[model samples]
Target: MSHADAGPDDDHPHEECGVIGVWNVADAAALTALGLHALQHRGQEATGIVTFDGARFHSHRGLGLVGDNFSDARVIARLPGTRAIGHNRYATTGETILRNVQPLFADFEFGGLAVGHNGNLTNAQALRRALVRRGCLFQSTTDSEVFIHLIAISLYSSITDRLIDALKQVSGAYSLVALSDQALYGVRDPLGVRPLILGRIGGGPGGWVLASETCALEIVGAEFVRDIEPGEIVVINDAGVHSIKPFSRQNSRFCVFEYIYFARPDSVMDGMAVYEARKRIGAELARESRVPADVIVPVPDSGVPAAMGYALESGIEFELGIIRNHYIGRTFIEPTDQIRNLGVKLKHSANRGVLAGKRVVLVDDSIVRGTTSRKIVEMVRAAGAAEVHMRISSPPTTHSCFYGIDTPERDQLLAAHHDLAQMTELIGADSLAFISLDGLYRALGKPGRDPASPAYCDACFTGSYPIALSDHDAAPERQLSLLASAP
Candidate 1:
C-alpha cells in the first residue's frame, strides 16, 4: 500500500512544532537544544537552531528528532553564541526534509535574522508569488520563509521598525521567536491564532525565554510572566525588554485544538489547562451523548482522558481494552501487508478477556479520514465485542485546517462525506455520535460566547477562517490534485 494508505491512522492531522528562544546566555545553543527536547512532542520530523555569537551567527539543522539531529558532537560544537532560537518541526507546508527545517537564517542589509515559527501563515502563497514576481528566489516550500523576505525589504529606519512593518502586511496564525546579533524578538499575530509565552530565569546573568508552550519554560526553569499579547512584539536585549503594540485591539481566536490534541497536557495556554480542557470535553461528551455499553474503552493516548470522563459521568465500567506499545518509533517499518495488517495490533492490542462477549463503547478524540476508526472497530469485533458503539468528544471535522495543521483535504474528511448513520455503517459501529459544536465550546468554558472571541477558533468545524483566503490563495484545486497524487 502507498504511504497514505499504509495504516488507518496514518492520515490523521499533525500539528507542526514547538519554538524556544533565549537572549544572551553562555550556552545558548545547548540550552535551546534542551528546550527543544522538552517540547519535542509538538513536532518530530526535524530540528534546527541558530545562534548569534556577538560577532556572527552559527547554525545546525537536520531531519530527525532533537536528540538525533543534535547527536553529532561536531554539529553541536559548531553552533556557538549568547543569543539563540530553536525549532522542532513536523512539516505541514513543506516536505519532511533537512532543507525545510527551521531557525531559518538570512542575511539582509540590516545584518542577520534567524526565526523559529510555531504556526501557519494563511497568506504565504500569495506573498511568495508576489515576491517571485518581484524577482525574489525561494529555497523551500514553507510559508515561514516569506516572513524573512518581508522583513528583508521593509524600508524602515532600523531593524526593529523593519520587522514591525513586515508583520503588518502578513495575516494568519504565528507565534514567532527571532534572534539577531544584539537582540531576541517574540511576536504574536493580530488575531492571536497561536500561543507564545514569556518567562525569565535567574538574575544578573539571567535571560528571557520565549516558547510556544509554558511547559517548556517550566522545563528550562523559567518563571512564567505572561502571554505575549496579540499584535504585540517583545524585544529582549542587554538594555532589557521593550514592548511594541502596533495593531488595533481585535478579537482573539486561539485555536481550540491546541488543548484537545496538540499541546502537552502539562502546558497552560491563556490560563486554560490542556489536560483539564480535554477531561472536560470527555465530561461534556458523557452529558451530551451517552451510549449503552458493558464497558468503556478509549482509543489510547488522546482518547484516555475523555474515556475516563465518559465512564465517570455515565457510571459505566471503564476497562483497559487496548494496550499500546510505547516503544514503537515512527520509523519502525514492517515489510508486508500481513505485517502491516497488524498495524493497530502492533501499536495497540485488544484485551480479549476484558472485551469478550461485552457490549462496548469506544471513545476517540475525532475521526478525520475515518480509515483508523474502521480498523479499530474491526479489531474490537475480532476480539469478541458483542456490540460496539463509537463516541467522539469533539465536533466532526469537516473543513480543512490552514493554520499549521496537517488535516486532509475537505473531500478526504469522512464527516464531510457522510452523516452519523453513514459513518456508523462505514466504521462498522452499531451506533456513532459526535459531541455537538455548542457542546464542545461549552466544555471549553466558552459557552454562548461570541465566535470572534479569543477563547476559541473553531474554523475546522465551522469554516469561519478569520483571515481572508484570497490574500494567500495558492489555488485549492492545484493543492488538492497534488495530495491526490500522494504515494
Candidate 2:
C-alpha cells in the first residue's frame, strides 16, 4: 500500500507496484495483461510480462501504463506460453529507467528463471555491496536483481530450494511471482507485510492465478481460493497447487494502510472489504471529531467512500464541493515557470456554487505532507468556504515506512514536526482531526492496537519499524552512495 518517491510537488503516498501470474493456461500473456489492467491503480509507470511455452521463454516489457504498453494484440501474442508472470511498476528501489522494468529474466544452469517482485528489500544495499565484493557484476540497480544473483550463487538442490535460500538472506517485505519451465511460484514475506492471493481459473480443468489483490482475480474470471499465507511458497502447474513453508513463521503484520487507501474498494484483504473498512474508519472519525459545518465534502476519489460513511453516521449531507479531473498523468511539467503550484489545480477544481458561504468538512484518507491539504484548503477558501475543517481517515503519518512504501525521512514528515494545533494553523483549516490509532484498529474489526505487539504494520504512524533497517538506518555516506548507484 505504498508508492515510489513522488516529487515534493506531488506530495502524496504512492503504491510501489502490482504483480500477477498464471500457470497452465492458454493465452497466458493476454490473461496476464487483463489482470494487470485490473491492478493498474497500484502503479502506472511501467509494465512487463514473461511467459514460457514449456521450452523457450518470451517477454515484452516497456515503460508506461499497462494498457499503453500491452493493449495491442500483437504485443500479447509475442509472449506465447502456458505459464507467465507480470508486473505494473513504479520503481521503488531502482531508478525510473527501461532496464529496471521487471519480470527480470535470467538464464540459469538449471533452466530459465523470470521474476516479478513487489515491495522493497530492506537489506538490499547491504546485500548488494556484499554480492559486489564477491565478484558479481550487477545488471540493474533493482533489489529484485539480488534474487537472481543470490540464486545463481546458491548451492541448493532444487530451484525452489535456491529461491528459499536467496529469500533467507534478504529482509523486508515482498510478494513475488516467478516463472520456470516446470512451474510458476508465488511467495510472501514471513510477517505477510505485503499482499498475495491464490485463485483458480475454473473449477478444476483450468489453471491457477496469483496476484497482489483479489480484484485482479475477478477481472480474469478467476475465483478466490484463499490468501497465500505469510512465510508461504506455493507452486502452481499442471499437477495443481502445492504449498510449502520455507521460512520460519512470524507474527502477521499486514500493512494497515491498504485498508485505508491503497487497495481498491471492491478488493478484499485479510477477509475484509477495503471499502467497508474505510467507511468504518470514517464513522469512527465522525464520532471522535464532531464539528459544526453546513456540509461534508470529500477530497474526491479516495475520500469519497469515507465521506459517505461520515455522512451516514453523522447525519450530515455530503456534497461534491471539489471535482477531480479523472485523466491527469502521474507527473506533470509546468508550462510556465511563473505559475507556482499549478499542479494541484490541474487535477482538482473547487465548485464555487456549492462551496460558497458554506462551512465545510473536507474528508481525505491521510496527510503525508501538509502541502496537499494546504493547497486544497486554499482552493476551497478561494471558492468562498466560510469555514474549512479537515478530517483524515487515518492517523497522522509521522514516521517513514521501511518495508516498501517510499516515504520522506521522519524529519520531513509534517506530523513528525507539527502537533495537531500547529498542523491546523499550517494547513489553514479551522479545525483538523485524524482517526485515532485505536479508532483505525477498531474499524478493521480488531481491538485497539497493542503497543507491546501490534497485529498490523503501523510503522509510518507509530515510528516502530517491525523489521530491522539494516541499510537505510546505516551511515549517511552509504545511503548517498546507494542513491548515486541507482541513477
Please give me the total number of clashing residue pairs in predicted model 2. Answer: 5
Clashing pairs in 2: 2-14, 2-15, 2-16, 3-14, 3-15
lDDT of 1 at 429: 94
| TM agreement with the true structure for every prediction | 0.92, 0.95
Candidate 2 least-lDDT 10 residues: 1-10
User: Residue 61, candidate 2: how far off, in angstroms?
Assistant: 0.6
Could you give candidate 2's per-residue lDDT for residues 245-351 as a string of tens digits?
A: 97777889999988888888899998899988888999999999989888999987889889988988899999999998766554553455444367678778999
Each prediction's RMSD over C-alphas, in Å, is: 3.9, 3.6
Question: Candidate 1 at residue 304, lDDT?
Answer: 83
For model 1 the local lDDT of residue 116 reads 86
Instruction: Give the range where candidate 1 is weakest over 10 consecutive residues by summed lDDT.
Output: 1-10
Candidate 2, superposed: residue stretches over 4 Å from native: 1-8, 203-206, 330-335, 476-487
